[model samples]
Target chain A: GAGVSQSPSNKVTEKGKDVELRCDPISGHTALYWYRQSLGQGLEFLIYFQGNSAPDKSGLPSDRFSAERTGGSVSTLTIQRTQQEDSAVYLCASSFAGGNSPLHFGNGTRLTVT
Target chain B: LAKTTQPISMDSYEGQEVNITCSHNNIATNDYITWYQQFPSQGPRFIIQGYKTKVTNEVASLFIPADRKSSTLSLPRVSLSDTAVYYCLVGDEPISSGSARQLTFGSGTQLTVLP
Candidate 1:
Protein backbone atom coordinates (compact mmCIF):
# COMPACT_ATOMS: atom_id res chain seq x y z
CA GLY A 1 0.00 0.00 0.00
CA ALA A 2 1.06 3.61 -0.43
CA GLY A 3 0.57 4.36 3.25
CA VAL A 4 -0.51 2.70 6.45
CA SER A 5 -4.03 1.30 6.14
CA GLN A 6 -6.48 0.47 8.92
CA SER A 7 -9.78 -1.40 8.65
CA PRO A 8 -13.26 -0.64 10.05
CA SER A 9 -12.74 3.10 10.49
CA ASN A 10 -15.33 3.11 13.27
CA LYS A 11 -16.46 0.44 15.69
CA VAL A 12 -19.22 0.45 18.30
CA THR A 13 -19.06 -2.40 20.78
CA GLU A 14 -20.78 -3.16 24.05
CA LYS A 15 -18.93 -3.45 27.29
CA GLY A 16 -17.43 -6.91 27.88
CA LYS A 17 -17.30 -7.59 24.15
CA ASP A 18 -14.14 -8.14 22.17
CA VAL A 19 -12.94 -5.89 19.38
CA GLU A 20 -10.22 -6.29 16.78
CA LEU A 21 -8.48 -3.50 14.82
CA ARG A 22 -6.31 -4.28 11.84
CA CYS A 23 -3.43 -2.40 10.26
CA ASP A 24 -1.55 -2.92 7.01
CA PRO A 25 1.72 -1.07 6.77
CA ILE A 26 3.52 0.09 3.69
CA SER A 27 5.48 -2.50 1.77
CA GLY A 28 9.10 -3.08 2.86
CA HIS A 29 8.70 -1.12 6.11
CA THR A 30 10.23 -3.01 9.00
CA ALA A 31 8.85 -1.10 11.97
CA LEU A 32 5.24 -0.79 13.22
CA TYR A 33 3.63 0.87 16.22
CA TRP A 34 0.25 1.03 17.99
CA TYR A 35 -1.15 3.91 20.01
CA ARG A 36 -4.41 4.85 21.69
CA GLN A 37 -5.93 8.31 22.05
CA SER A 38 -8.88 9.09 24.26
CA LEU A 39 -11.17 12.09 23.88
CA GLY A 40 -9.09 15.27 24.38
CA GLN A 41 -6.06 13.28 25.49
CA GLY A 42 -2.55 12.66 24.26
CA LEU A 43 -1.62 9.51 22.37
CA GLU A 44 -0.55 6.60 24.57
CA PHE A 45 1.94 4.17 23.10
CA LEU A 46 0.74 0.59 23.21
CA ILE A 47 3.21 -1.63 21.41
CA TYR A 48 5.99 -1.70 18.82
CA PHE A 49 7.37 -4.30 16.42
CA GLN A 50 10.71 -4.20 14.62
CA GLY A 51 11.49 -6.78 12.02
CA ASN A 52 11.49 -10.27 13.60
CA SER A 53 12.19 -9.17 17.14
CA ALA A 54 9.83 -9.56 20.07
CA PRO A 55 7.22 -6.83 20.25
CA ASP A 56 7.31 -4.16 22.91
CA LYS A 57 4.20 -4.63 25.04
CA SER A 58 5.03 -2.39 27.97
CA GLY A 59 2.48 0.24 27.01
CA LEU A 60 -0.53 -2.10 26.92
CA PRO A 61 -2.83 -0.85 29.67
CA SER A 62 -3.77 -4.28 30.96
CA ASP A 63 -3.81 -7.97 30.25
CA ARG A 64 -6.98 -7.59 28.20
CA PHE A 65 -5.10 -5.76 25.49
CA SER A 66 -2.92 -7.76 23.10
CA ALA A 67 -1.56 -7.44 19.58
CA GLU A 68 0.15 -9.52 16.91
CA ARG A 69 1.98 -8.75 13.68
CA THR A 70 1.97 -11.42 11.01
CA GLY A 71 4.51 -11.86 8.18
CA GLY A 72 6.08 -8.53 9.17
CA SER A 73 3.40 -6.65 7.30
CA VAL A 74 -0.14 -6.76 8.70
CA SER A 75 -0.86 -6.24 12.38
CA THR A 76 -3.90 -6.64 14.61
CA LEU A 77 -4.78 -5.15 17.95
CA THR A 78 -7.25 -7.10 20.08
CA ILE A 79 -9.02 -5.70 23.10
CA GLN A 80 -10.86 -8.27 25.19
CA ARG A 81 -13.70 -7.55 27.62
CA THR A 82 -13.77 -3.97 26.55
CA GLN A 83 -14.84 -1.35 29.01
CA GLN A 84 -16.31 2.11 28.61
CA GLU A 85 -12.94 3.64 29.32
CA ASP A 86 -11.54 1.77 26.36
CA SER A 87 -13.38 4.09 23.99
CA ALA A 88 -10.69 5.76 21.92
CA VAL A 89 -9.01 5.89 18.54
CA TYR A 90 -6.44 3.19 17.89
CA LEU A 91 -3.66 4.37 15.59
CA CYS A 92 -1.08 2.36 13.66
CA ALA A 93 2.16 3.66 12.18
CA SER A 94 5.07 2.28 10.16
CA SER A 95 8.58 3.35 9.28
CA PHE A 96 11.76 2.15 7.67
CA ALA A 97 14.36 0.19 9.60
CA GLY A 98 16.61 3.07 10.68
CA GLY A 99 15.87 5.30 13.64
CA ASN A 100 15.94 8.50 11.61
CA SER A 101 13.13 7.47 9.30
CA PRO A 102 9.83 9.30 9.76
CA LEU A 103 6.68 7.36 10.62
CA HIS A 104 3.66 7.05 8.38
CA PHE A 105 0.35 6.84 10.21
CA GLY A 106 -3.05 5.42 9.34
CA ASN A 107 -6.36 7.19 9.79
CA GLY A 108 -6.99 4.91 12.76
CA THR A 109 -9.99 2.99 14.13
CA ARG A 110 -12.39 4.77 16.43
CA LEU A 111 -13.72 2.29 19.01
CA THR A 112 -16.65 3.21 21.15
CA VAL A 113 -17.60 0.89 24.00
CA THR A 114 -21.03 1.57 25.37
CA LEU B 1 13.03 8.26 25.74
CA ALA B 2 13.15 12.06 26.10
CA LYS B 3 10.20 13.93 27.56
CA THR B 4 8.93 16.99 25.69
CA THR B 5 6.94 19.99 26.85
CA GLN B 6 4.89 22.32 24.65
CA PRO B 7 2.19 24.92 25.07
CA ILE B 8 -1.40 23.85 25.57
CA SER B 9 -2.73 26.21 22.90
CA MET B 10 -1.80 29.01 20.51
CA ASP B 11 -3.68 31.44 18.33
CA SER B 12 -2.67 32.97 15.00
CA TYR B 13 -4.27 34.86 12.17
CA GLU B 14 -4.31 33.71 8.60
CA GLY B 15 -1.20 34.58 6.55
CA GLN B 16 0.79 35.12 9.71
CA GLU B 17 3.88 33.18 10.68
CA VAL B 18 3.56 30.71 13.53
CA ASN B 19 6.22 29.13 15.65
CA ILE B 20 5.72 26.37 18.20
CA THR B 21 8.51 25.49 20.57
CA CYS B 22 9.16 22.23 22.43
CA SER B 23 11.44 21.74 25.41
CA HIS B 24 13.47 18.62 26.11
CA ASN B 25 15.77 19.47 28.95
CA ASN B 26 17.15 15.96 29.38
CA ILE B 27 17.56 14.84 25.82
CA ALA B 28 20.20 12.20 25.34
CA THR B 29 23.05 12.17 22.83
CA ASN B 30 21.43 9.69 20.47
CA ASP B 31 17.97 11.22 20.57
CA TYR B 32 16.54 12.96 17.52
CA ILE B 33 13.75 15.52 17.53
CA THR B 34 10.64 15.00 15.41
CA TRP B 35 7.39 16.89 14.93
CA TYR B 36 3.93 15.74 13.89
CA GLN B 37 0.63 17.46 13.21
CA GLN B 38 -2.82 15.96 13.73
CA PHE B 39 -6.28 17.18 12.94
CA PRO B 40 -9.47 16.24 14.76
CA SER B 41 -10.33 12.55 14.29
CA GLN B 42 -7.21 11.87 12.25
CA GLY B 43 -3.89 10.28 13.03
CA PRO B 44 -0.78 12.38 13.38
CA ARG B 45 1.11 13.27 10.22
CA PHE B 46 4.84 13.69 10.17
CA ILE B 47 5.87 17.35 9.71
CA ILE B 48 9.61 17.48 10.12
CA GLN B 49 12.63 16.02 11.90
CA GLY B 50 16.03 17.41 12.83
CA TYR B 51 19.01 16.69 14.97
CA LYS B 52 20.63 20.12 15.14
CA THR B 53 20.67 23.51 13.42
CA LYS B 54 17.84 23.98 10.94
CA VAL B 55 16.01 21.83 8.44
CA THR B 56 13.39 23.07 6.00
CA ASN B 57 11.01 21.19 3.75
CA GLU B 58 8.04 22.13 1.65
CA VAL B 59 5.74 22.00 4.67
CA ALA B 60 7.67 23.50 7.59
CA SER B 61 11.06 24.22 9.15
CA LEU B 62 12.66 22.77 12.27
CA PHE B 63 15.28 24.60 14.37
CA ILE B 64 17.39 22.99 17.01
CA PRO B 65 20.02 24.73 19.10
CA ALA B 66 23.50 23.61 20.01
CA ASP B 67 22.49 22.71 23.57
CA ARG B 68 19.71 20.54 22.14
CA LYS B 69 17.49 21.43 25.07
CA SER B 70 14.66 22.68 22.84
CA SER B 71 13.45 22.92 19.24
CA THR B 72 11.07 25.06 17.23
CA LEU B 73 8.69 24.39 14.33
CA SER B 74 8.05 27.35 12.08
CA LEU B 75 5.25 27.67 9.55
CA PRO B 76 5.75 30.31 6.93
CA ARG B 77 2.18 31.47 6.27
CA VAL B 78 -0.61 29.99 8.29
CA SER B 79 -4.10 29.20 7.03
CA LEU B 80 -7.28 27.87 8.54
CA SER B 81 -6.32 24.43 7.33
CA ASP B 82 -3.16 24.69 9.42
CA THR B 83 -5.17 24.59 12.60
CA ALA B 84 -4.32 21.35 14.29
CA VAL B 85 -2.55 19.73 17.23
CA TYR B 86 1.22 19.68 16.79
CA TYR B 87 3.23 17.11 18.69
CA CYS B 88 6.94 17.00 19.51
CA LEU B 89 8.64 13.66 20.03
CA VAL B 90 12.19 12.59 20.98
CA GLY B 91 13.70 9.15 21.07
CA ASP B 92 16.74 7.09 20.15
CA GLU B 93 16.88 4.34 17.54
CA PRO B 94 13.16 4.49 16.74
CA ILE B 95 14.04 1.36 14.79
CA SER B 96 16.31 -1.54 15.85
CA SER B 97 15.53 -0.94 19.51
CA GLY B 98 14.43 -3.85 21.61
CA SER B 99 11.14 -4.13 23.50
CA ALA B 100 10.13 -1.20 25.73
CA ARG B 101 11.80 1.31 23.41
CA GLN B 102 9.63 3.58 21.27
CA LEU B 103 8.60 7.15 20.72
CA THR B 104 6.29 8.68 23.33
CA PHE B 105 3.82 11.50 22.64
CA GLY B 106 2.93 14.35 24.95
CA SER B 107 -0.29 16.33 25.10
CA GLY B 108 0.97 18.54 22.21
CA THR B 109 0.24 22.16 21.34
CA GLN B 110 -3.07 23.09 19.78
CA LEU B 111 -2.66 25.79 17.12
CA THR B 112 -5.73 27.71 15.99
CA VAL B 113 -5.62 29.82 12.87
CA LEU B 114 -8.31 32.44 12.83
CA PRO B 115 -9.57 34.56 9.99
Candidate 2:
Protein backbone atom coordinates (compact mmCIF):
# COMPACT_ATOMS: atom_id res chain seq x y z
CA GLY A 1 0.00 0.00 0.00
CA ALA A 2 1.14 3.53 -0.72
CA GLY A 3 1.99 5.66 2.29
CA VAL A 4 0.67 9.08 3.02
CA SER A 5 2.18 11.81 0.83
CA GLN A 6 2.71 15.57 1.09
CA SER A 7 3.63 18.08 -1.57
CA PRO A 8 6.39 20.68 -1.86
CA SER A 9 9.01 18.89 0.24
CA ASN A 10 10.42 22.32 1.13
CA LYS A 11 9.04 25.83 0.92
CA VAL A 12 10.67 29.20 1.50
CA THR A 13 8.53 32.29 1.71
CA GLU A 14 8.90 35.89 2.89
CA LYS A 15 7.12 37.14 5.95
CA GLY A 16 3.49 38.28 5.52
CA LYS A 17 2.91 35.88 2.66
CA ASP A 18 0.43 33.04 2.58
CA VAL A 19 1.25 29.44 1.78
CA GLU A 20 -0.70 26.26 1.27
CA LEU A 21 0.59 22.79 2.07
CA ARG A 22 -1.18 19.74 0.69
CA CYS A 23 -1.48 16.16 1.87
CA ASP A 24 -2.85 12.99 0.28
CA PRO A 25 -3.78 10.32 2.73
CA ILE A 26 -3.68 6.61 2.08
CA SER A 27 -6.67 5.16 0.36
CA GLY A 28 -9.74 4.39 2.54
CA HIS A 29 -8.41 6.46 5.42
CA THR A 30 -11.22 8.62 6.75
CA ALA A 31 -9.38 10.41 9.52
CA LEU A 32 -6.81 13.05 8.59
CA TYR A 33 -4.70 15.30 10.79
CA TRP A 34 -2.26 18.19 10.40
CA TYR A 35 0.59 19.00 12.74
CA ARG A 36 3.37 21.54 13.02
CA GLN A 37 6.87 20.89 14.29
CA SER A 38 9.09 23.83 15.12
CA LEU A 39 12.84 23.44 15.42
CA GLY A 40 13.88 21.74 18.64
CA GLN A 41 10.25 21.50 19.66
CA GLY A 42 7.63 18.78 19.97
CA LEU A 43 4.89 18.07 17.47
CA GLU A 44 2.10 20.65 17.67
CA PHE A 45 -1.38 19.64 16.60
CA LEU A 46 -3.22 21.83 14.14
CA ILE A 47 -6.50 20.39 12.85
CA TYR A 48 -8.22 17.10 12.16
CA PHE A 49 -11.03 15.61 10.09
CA GLN A 50 -13.01 12.41 10.58
CA GLY A 51 -15.56 11.50 7.97
CA ASN A 52 -18.67 13.69 8.17
CA SER A 53 -18.08 14.73 11.73
CA ALA A 54 -17.15 18.27 12.59
CA PRO A 55 -13.45 18.93 12.14
CA ASP A 56 -11.37 19.45 15.23
CA LYS A 57 -9.60 22.77 15.30
CA SER A 58 -8.85 23.14 18.96
CA GLY A 59 -5.12 22.72 18.46
CA LEU A 60 -4.83 25.30 15.77
CA PRO A 61 -2.54 28.04 17.09
CA SER A 62 -4.47 30.95 15.73
CA ASP A 63 -7.17 32.06 13.38
CA ARG A 64 -4.61 32.55 10.66
CA PHE A 65 -4.02 28.84 10.48
CA SER A 66 -6.74 26.82 8.82
CA ALA A 67 -7.05 23.36 7.27
CA GLU A 68 -9.64 21.53 5.20
CA ARG A 69 -9.92 17.91 4.10
CA THR A 70 -11.97 17.69 0.97
CA GLY A 71 -13.81 14.50 -0.03
CA GLY A 72 -12.30 12.87 3.05
CA SER A 73 -9.18 12.02 1.13
CA VAL A 74 -6.90 15.03 0.69
CA SER A 75 -6.22 17.93 2.99
CA THR A 76 -4.77 21.40 2.67
CA LEU A 77 -3.18 23.43 5.44
CA THR A 78 -3.08 27.13 4.80
CA ILE A 79 -1.09 29.71 6.66
CA GLN A 80 -2.16 33.30 6.30
CA ARG A 81 0.39 36.08 6.70
CA THR A 82 3.26 33.86 7.64
CA GLN A 83 5.81 34.89 10.24
CA GLN A 84 9.33 33.88 11.06
CA GLU A 85 7.99 31.84 13.93
CA ASP A 86 6.01 29.84 11.42
CA SER A 87 9.21 28.28 10.16
CA ALA A 88 8.72 24.61 10.86
CA VAL A 89 7.85 21.25 9.36
CA TYR A 90 4.18 20.68 8.55
CA LEU A 91 3.24 17.03 8.90
CA CYS A 92 0.15 15.13 7.82
CA ALA A 93 -1.20 11.84 9.09
CA SER A 94 -4.14 9.51 8.56
CA SER A 95 -5.83 6.72 10.42
CA PHE A 96 -8.66 4.27 9.82
CA ALA A 97 -10.86 5.92 12.41
CA GLY A 98 -10.75 8.12 15.46
CA GLY A 99 -9.21 6.28 18.42
CA ASN A 100 -9.34 2.87 16.77
CA SER A 101 -6.13 2.69 14.70
CA PRO A 102 -2.66 4.14 14.91
CA LEU A 103 -1.73 7.09 12.72
CA HIS A 104 0.41 6.83 9.60
CA PHE A 105 2.47 9.92 8.82
CA GLY A 106 3.87 11.51 5.68
CA ASN A 107 7.39 12.86 5.28
CA GLY A 108 6.02 16.39 5.77
CA THR A 109 6.68 19.78 4.20
CA ARG A 110 9.43 21.93 5.64
CA LEU A 111 8.37 25.57 5.62
CA THR A 112 10.99 28.23 6.11
CA VAL A 113 9.75 31.75 6.63
CA THR A 114 12.24 34.54 6.21
CA LEU B 1 -4.42 15.07 30.05
CA ALA B 2 -1.27 14.00 31.88
CA LYS B 3 2.06 15.78 31.90
CA THR B 4 4.99 13.51 31.02
CA THR B 5 8.47 13.84 32.49
CA GLN B 6 11.48 12.13 30.91
CA PRO B 7 15.20 12.57 30.66
CA ILE B 8 16.25 15.28 28.25
CA SER B 9 18.94 13.14 26.72
CA MET B 10 20.64 9.76 26.96
CA ASP B 11 23.55 8.03 25.25
CA SER B 12 24.18 4.34 24.67
CA TYR B 13 26.76 2.33 22.77
CA GLU B 14 25.68 0.11 19.93
CA GLY B 15 24.46 -3.43 20.80
CA GLN B 16 23.38 -2.28 24.27
CA GLU B 17 19.86 -2.38 25.61
CA VAL B 18 18.38 1.08 26.22
CA ASN B 19 15.51 1.83 28.54
CA ILE B 20 13.81 5.21 28.75
CA THR B 21 11.28 5.87 31.47
CA CYS B 22 8.44 8.41 31.38
CA SER B 23 6.41 9.60 34.36
CA HIS B 24 2.78 10.65 34.16
CA ASN B 25 1.29 10.79 37.63
CA ASN B 26 -2.05 12.04 36.39
CA ILE B 27 -2.72 9.45 33.75
CA ALA B 28 -6.44 8.72 33.38
CA THR B 29 -8.29 5.47 32.89
CA ASN B 30 -9.17 6.22 29.27
CA ASP B 31 -5.74 7.51 28.44
CA TYR B 32 -3.40 5.13 26.68
CA ILE B 33 0.38 5.44 26.75
CA THR B 34 2.01 5.61 23.34
CA TRP B 35 5.60 6.08 22.27
CA TYR B 36 6.90 7.58 19.06
CA GLN B 37 10.37 7.75 17.48
CA GLN B 38 11.33 10.75 15.39
CA PHE B 39 14.45 11.42 13.38
CA PRO B 40 15.81 14.74 12.24
CA SER B 41 13.93 16.24 9.31
CA GLN B 42 11.14 13.64 9.52
CA GLY B 43 7.76 13.00 11.09
CA PRO B 44 7.45 10.70 14.05
CA ARG B 45 6.95 6.94 13.71
CA PHE B 46 4.89 4.95 16.17
CA ILE B 47 6.81 2.51 18.30
CA ILE B 48 4.46 0.91 20.78
CA GLN B 49 1.32 1.43 22.86
CA GLY B 50 0.11 0.00 26.14
CA TYR B 51 -2.60 0.41 28.75
CA LYS B 52 -1.04 -1.47 31.66
CA THR B 53 1.38 -4.24 32.48
CA LYS B 54 3.58 -4.85 29.43
CA VAL B 55 3.30 -4.81 25.66
CA THR B 56 5.97 -6.07 23.29
CA ASN B 57 6.23 -5.62 19.56
CA GLU B 58 8.72 -6.62 16.95
CA VAL B 59 10.57 -3.29 17.12
CA ALA B 60 10.47 -2.61 20.87
CA SER B 61 8.82 -3.34 24.21
CA LEU B 62 6.72 -1.27 26.60
CA PHE B 63 6.53 -2.00 30.31
CA ILE B 64 3.88 -0.42 32.49
CA PRO B 65 3.69 -1.17 36.16
CA ALA B 66 0.60 -1.76 38.29
CA ASP B 67 0.49 1.90 39.27
CA ARG B 68 0.23 2.94 35.62
CA LYS B 69 1.69 6.27 36.65
CA SER B 70 4.77 5.64 34.53
CA SER B 71 5.98 3.52 31.63
CA THR B 72 9.25 2.37 30.13
CA LEU B 73 10.31 1.88 26.50
CA SER B 74 12.94 -0.80 26.10
CA LEU B 75 14.89 -1.13 22.91
CA PRO B 76 16.96 -4.27 22.42
CA ARG B 77 20.45 -4.12 20.99
CA VAL B 78 20.15 -0.57 19.79
CA SER B 79 22.12 0.44 16.71
CA LEU B 80 23.51 3.78 15.55
CA SER B 81 20.48 4.30 13.35
CA ASP B 82 18.27 4.16 16.45
CA THR B 83 19.59 7.52 17.57
CA ALA B 84 16.65 9.88 17.62
CA VAL B 85 14.11 11.62 19.80
CA TYR B 86 11.52 9.51 21.57
CA TYR B 87 8.21 10.98 22.73
CA CYS B 88 5.73 9.54 25.24
CA LEU B 89 2.14 10.60 24.78
CA VAL B 90 -1.08 9.95 26.74
CA GLY B 91 -4.41 10.54 25.07
CA ASP B 92 -8.06 9.48 25.25
CA GLU B 93 -11.12 9.39 23.04
CA PRO B 94 -12.19 12.86 22.00
CA ILE B 95 -15.22 14.30 23.79
CA SER B 96 -16.59 15.77 20.59
CA SER B 97 -16.07 15.73 16.88
CA GLY B 98 -14.36 19.09 17.33
CA SER B 99 -11.81 17.69 19.77
CA ALA B 100 -8.48 17.02 18.16
CA ARG B 101 -6.71 13.78 18.92
CA GLN B 102 -3.78 16.12 19.20
CA LEU B 103 -1.17 14.47 21.35
CA THR B 104 0.45 16.48 24.10
CA PHE B 105 4.09 15.86 23.21
CA GLY B 106 6.67 16.55 25.89
CA SER B 107 10.27 17.64 25.59
CA GLY B 108 11.19 14.20 24.27
CA THR B 109 14.14 12.12 25.36
CA GLN B 110 16.90 12.31 22.78
CA LEU B 111 18.65 8.95 22.50
CA THR B 112 22.13 8.91 20.99
CA VAL B 113 23.16 5.43 19.93
CA LEU B 114 26.90 5.61 19.44
CA PRO B 115 28.87 2.91 17.65
**Highest-DockQ candidate:** 1
C-alpha RMSD in Å of predicted model 1 compared with the true structure: 1.3
Model 1, residue A49: displacement in angstroms? 0.7
DockQ of each: 0.72, 0.60
Best by TM-score: 1
> What does candidate 1's lDDT look like per residue over A65-84, in tens digits?
98998898999999999999
Model 1 stretches with alpha carbons more than 4 Å out: B99-102
Report the poorest 10 consecutive residues by lDDT, candidate 1 chain B: B93-102
Q: Write the per-residue lDDT of candidate 2 for residues B16-80, one digit (tens) a residue.
A: 99999999999877778999999998878889998999999999999999999999999999999
Best by lDDT: 1
Report the lDDT tens digits of candidate 2 across residue range A1-114. Answer: 899999999999999999999999999988788888888988888777886344578888888898877787888889999999999999998878755366788989999999
Clashing pairs in 2: none
- Regions of candidate 2 where Cα sits further than 4 Å from its true position: A52-54, A98-100, B95-98
TM-score of structure candidate 2: 0.94
lDDT of 1 by residue, B1-115 (tens): 6789999999999999999999999998888899999999899999999999999999999999999999999999999999999999988765445643548999999999999
> TM-scores of the models, in the given order?
0.96, 0.94
